[model samples]
Target: MTSDGVTTSRVVADVARELEIELPTLSSRMASSFLNQIPALQGDDAVTQLVVASTSSNLSTVIDVLQHGIPLHQISVPAAAAAHARRFAQRELPVEALLRAYRLGESQFVQWCLRLLAARSLDAAELLAAVQEITSVAARYIDQVCEHLVDIYETERRLWGQRADAARAASVRTVLGDETLDVGTAEAMIGARLRGWHVAAVAWLQSDPSDAARRVESAAQLLTEAYGRSPLTVLADDHTLWAWVSGTSRPRLDEQVLDRALVSHPDLHLALGDPGPDLAGFRSSHREALKAKAVAQMSGGTTARLTRFATVSISALLLDRLDEVRTWVGRTLGDLARDDEAMAKLRDTVRIFLQTGGSFTDAAARLHLHKNTVHYRVRKAEEIRGRPLGDGRLDVEVALVICRQLGGGVLMR
Candidate 1:
């Protein structure tokens, strides 16, 4: 009998007997087709024995038949067995499969290596040999996957960076006073969220936007390290850097930190703002810093420092309105001092008189004259200037401030 016919008959009989079910006979064509599909099967002594034994009535007949000579363990449906083998070979699969697992693009080189590893179970040397065998195919895939991975990683990093930037902007806005915000509301918003206070020392490098940004970033890193909490944020303007610091307390911030941080770059001129409680204070602190920077610039020296807005008084600001004050002064005191030195003396006397708490005796003592002389100077000065030095005490005070700035009195040039 043909091998396929014999084998089918044996299997059907054995199964029917084991389950006590009625046997269904297989047709010759169907039996032959099934047998032909088994891999490595040949008409040999072992095959003949298995077919004969499997048809017997005993339960062990099927087992004994296969044990005659064939390796039953190795024999299985080729397609199903191949699929099972592939599962075991997954890790060793071609580079293509590896790329797929890693979400990389297709590459023939990787796929060939996987196939070779599966077919031969090769070691490192053999694997390298397999890789070499498919070099052209593998190299292309490797290059493609590598490039794709880099692009994907960079894209993801940029996206995350944007997210971080947005968060930082929101944090800054919340700290500063919004249109609907009051001092109490601003304080409450920052109270719990902020850990400390800090002041940022900002400077720009030759008006180059890139260099300015780098300097700001470098200064921020240095400050962060020194204070262990303070961080700097920079706002860019032409030839200017608005450096802001955030920390818990101004006193707690270490000046030495800034000294060292700024030491590395000589090109930067740092103007430090007051330590802000949170980012909201950045605006105020920045404003103060800009004024301080202007003061530093006017001083014509690098070491000049101004930390507080109060250091520069409103009087100083008024003095800055010199052009406007000049017109008024010229109009009021025009030619009054040309002939009457006494008139000039009276002007100085009136300033002293008001400054000394309206005491004639104190004014006389300050001016090194008798009290009557002081009173006479004030009356004469008021007559010449054509203005009463009456209860316009506020105007007198303001005028005195301008006089001092303009170097009026005996020192007038």
Candidate 2:
């Protein structure tokens, strides 16, 4: 009972009343500060208007509670406040921005109250009590409002993310399907350009499937890091991510980088397609990547983590008829296709020798062996096959590639 002969309650109430009148001014100032600080909030005219409305509503709501004696538990977030938070979630704006806005607003509002109290004819202790009361009430109101809004924002973000993912998945499926697509429309639907060369990739996690969405998406991004832009990625399933990168030219896969990524990512496997051009090229490239993935899956990860369509084209085509491929590999390479370490070395050396057009020196360089060792291995491979190197040169080379790519899948065990 002591501020310029005014009771403490009366003076505080009088100050709250004055603050109520200044709310419009306060809302405008805080809203400006929010836009300046949060670039995401700075949007079109309609968005700016929404921000003003939400800010004003929030300021007035807090002022009303301060001027009157309102119980916090009875309070709910202002409709405009809920709408603004939902908008942020729907637009994919981070919740951190909203929380930051609240923090800034709280500080400014408390300072504004302090300035007004300082202007009043009050003693230091009285001013401190009044300021404490206003600050506590304002801070508590903001804390309660922010907590509720956060719950709302999180709920909306989850629902929005699911809907967005479904829409994106549908668009991807339409583009991949045989629907007689218009390239322009398809590109718009998929939200990525269809021009230039396209390199398609399929990524999946081998373990830790619970983090499938995050880890699989990371795998696709990791595989296409050389493209210098984010690839168009879609979750094909819980554990699989399909992605395509477009650029002026085809991207070269860095084997060392890919191997390093595998170690960092843990149990991640990727299959890649050859780069193709334009809309039709997009479909063809994806088909090739799928084939490559099929081959990789068939090998049960005994193959490399990064499987390329260029190396496994034959294996991909024959993946469906693996038994037939096994029999053919057995016949073509004879005993040379045996799943034994010594036989494997001989088979590989002879395959290199034949691929180099019977050049022992070239094969030796490729195998990191002496020319004499290459010649000796070729002789042993021919003896095991019961034929001359020229008898079935083409078939021998193809069979050897299949054996190498498919490993024990096609080799006689």
Candidate 3:
């Protein structure tokens, strides 16, 4: 305790000085930790260096709060931290990933402090007080800084969205937002025809673009070129691109070919809508692609990088009403809704069983399980659902489809 009225122990002050001295090492280690846990946070060499700067600034801020007993309200996010947060937002990186980085960093900082304090020859009470102060300060500092960082992120994201190829984006947004607009006028604005069959698609990359416009256009072109030529492409944001490929005939899409092509462009995620005819098709098809994108985003599964509207149409339609879907899924599946590998395997078997008109032989062939094994899984699934699979079979089928497509998005949290 300090009679100087700073409300901080001299021991804490000394620790803070030690932290400042070790700032370079601590910052480097935590930066590595953040990237290791969430590889999406990594960037080019330039960005990796900036991450260390931000980490050092954030860690230094926490030390200041501990040493000075700074009030929560007076604390401000560091300039380096704020700048990197905005950069992350501009890149459209997952905000959840960035926020989680703060919590992980906080844990590391507390452990370091505790280890340093344990080496002191202090009495039990003093050691306890110092531990309490360090833990509380680090936690509170993270909370305060993260809240401010979110505001910075959101504001920058909104502004960044608004600033991307605005004229073309507004044109696309206008067409998508309205159904009654004249097809000719809309075509004139977008420089694309709406009189024929249309297949809409959304393409995006998680990494920062060296040449934003051209790279975004190339992404859209890659997804749309198979169906039609001179597709209309619009920049959605720094990280996303939207397109519509049109032709007189509805084009056939071979999923295998698409998958093979995407193997080369690892960063690109493509979502496609079904073929639709006319101006209404132009609008509706885009909505379907957006829906597929929604499910893909929720899943965040790399295997789903190439989502087709037809494959996930059911879950896409229900994405907007997911809160209801989650509740209904929980009710329909009962204990069967448990999110785990074993339960998932059982659910898949049951769904196949139901789909095959309760033919154990067919289900077994589809699942590569013996007929006896298929029967056992069906019985086990029924046991978990606490009822026979006879009633509400339709609802059961739909719920299984939802879980299969949505992954853990609608599973019991």
Candidate 4:
């Protein structure tokens, strides 16, 4: 029977007649040959029976017969049939057709092979032998095709790797710009979304670059886990890594995140910069981080050190320019009896007094001196400096800054 209730015998007769050949005898031989070659076609099913009946017929005649049930346009015809009159010849398949099929199937086949290898179900030696044996059959068909497949596979792998790298670069840029937080509206948005207000601190590593990179990554992860947000940005240079953390409070960060991050590495030192308000603070935090490192280096601190720009006293600034300030102090007050200790005490008093907003009582309290004792000291300082101590707030403030910048022992106490 044919696929759509047409008889296979009738189809065979029509195809043979169209091809000017004998019908029943040719149909029987073709059916037997088809059944032997393709076991699945041996059944007396409609589609198989029709295909068996048409095999010995001319390709066009067979196509016409099949078109009653199957679309004729979808059938591929043998071009050689038109060229040869006596014997039928097969058509050459397009190279693109084979290549397209291989491209679609190669990835799935490779994955299957990899999975089989990983499972350890197949012996490695046996698998290699089997592959070699299979390649012998493949080599008979085409030597260059196998080489082409290898080249194509490698090209695809490289393209995939490049795509992955591009994705990572995009992710890094997004994170650095704080784009995920919508930084433009950060203050309002963060306050609403976060459980509490956020505080930020920055730390930098000046030592090991690899360790610094790892630490920055770890610190970012830790901050994210604790705060439900990655408040950290890690900018890594050739020799340093700058890490910033933002959350609700300073103490929590100091105890939980920064302190814990540094606990394992005794040799690695960090400079923790002052906490800032939002994403805008990242730049400031980074700057302060470098400054903090300088401060730590000068101070000879063992552990990680924290420094705040706001807490930097005028004396600290003055001490930074100690030599210049010391020269000026000596030249300006040359007639005074030269006692280093006394001059240092006077410098400290002036720094404290100026920093406390010109309040003698506040300065004395910071100096831990009696009010009258502070008064006597200020008068003696005025006499030594050859200037009156009254209403000289600006002069005193400038001198204190200069003295602190000088880094002299004058303001150490």
lDDT of each: 0.44, 0.79, 0.79, 0.44
lDDT of 1 at 256: 73
Clashes of 2: 0
Model 3 reaches what TM-score against the true structure?
A: 0.63
Against the hidden reference, what TM-scores do the models get?
Answer: 0.32, 0.55, 0.63, 0.34
Model 2 clash pairs? none
Q: Which stretches of candidate 3 lie over 4 Å from their true place?
A: 1-166, 178-180, 206-216, 300-303
Q: Write the candidate numbers in order of decreasing TM-score.
A: 3, 2, 4, 1
* Order by lDDT, highest first: 3, 2, 1, 4
For model 3, residues 1-413, the per-residue Cα lDDT tens digits are 32232333777877888888998888888998987788767533234545777999888787887677678788788988887887677655678988898889988998998888888787766777787878887888888889999999999888877774666777777888676789999888876778989888888765665665566566654654455355677766555678887888886666676677777777778889998998999888888887787777666345476888898999988866777999999899998988888888898999999999999999999999899999999999999999988879899999998988887878885
lDDT of 2 by residue, 308-349 (tens): 899889888886677899999898888888888898889778
CA displacement after TM-score superposition, residue 388 of candidate 2 (Å): 1.6
TM-score of 2: 0.55
Worst 10 residues of 1 by lDDT: 84-93
